[model samples]
Target: MANRWLRPEVYPLFAAVGAAIGICGFQLVRNICINPEVRVSKEGRAAGVLENYAEGEKYAEHGLRKYLRNKTPEIMPSINSFFADPNRS
Candidate 1:
């Protein structure tokens, strides 16, 4: 008697189902491992703004020092005014 459990037609179906499950599992693992942290809180936004402001301050200071040393008339007025009163605008 032929073994019904070892049917040749069912092997392809089993292989296809196993392959799909493996693909889904791989995608799930990849998403969990590679996703970045997201910051959505008000405090996180404020911290980002403060960080940007600090970086801008450093850049402005460097530019002003360079301008002073070179005495570039084109950049002098704006940089000098900004340093003289940073809160003006």
Candidate 2:
């Protein structure tokens, strides 16, 4: 009976082959099904479906205002100090 499993160099070869197969499989799936699908919404309210730059800016400003209005008291000191820094260039 031959004991082929005793070879120490076979482990690296097996690992390399497994890594190659995994990478090739990942690339194949990414090329076929992982692509981004861009669909424009008729109602203009779906997530990640902004229609124009103006709408995006409006959303951003609204979000910032909401955050500032609801921010925690502990964070207020840091925020105030950042704006009050006269030496800021």
Candidate 3:
């Protein structure tokens, strides 16, 4: 009866879910360890007054944000470029 669950149709669903969960887990771990805003130790905490909140935010940017920082913010760049004439100044 358990063999009924082994059908080929469910493999992609399984892989997709696994990949999503794995990516989430990896980002979670990465944030917990590397993100400067997330301090795990007592010693890691700031003791004195600091004014550079943006500095911590600078280092705290997630993977996706870092990747998209330089790239144009668009849903479909190719399509937009095709519709937008380059001659218009």
Cα TM-score per model: 0.36, 0.34, 0.58
Instruction: Please report how far candidate 1 places residue 14 from its true position, in Å.
Output: 0.7
Q: Residue 77 CA error for candidate 1 (Å)?
A: 64
lDDT-best of 1 and 3: 3
Alpha carbon lDDT at 48, candidate 3: 42
Candidate 3 lDDT, 1-89, residue by residue in tens: 76787789889998999999999999899789766566777776754444677867776675678898999989998788878978655
Listed per candidate, the RMSD to the true structure in angstroms reads 23.3, 14.2, 4.4
In order, the Cα lDDT scores of the candidates are: 0.65, 0.63, 0.79
Error at 68, model 3, angstroms: 2.2
lDDT of 2 by residue, 1-89 (tens): 24586477788998998999999998677545433333334443356644566745553566558777876666578777789888865
Output the better candidate (1/3) by TM-score.
Answer: 3
* Positional deviation of residue 2's Cα in model 3 after best superposition, in angstroms: 3.1
Give lDDT tens digits, candidate 1, residues 4-81.
Answer: 856998899989999999999986774454322223566754665344556455545665487678665665787788
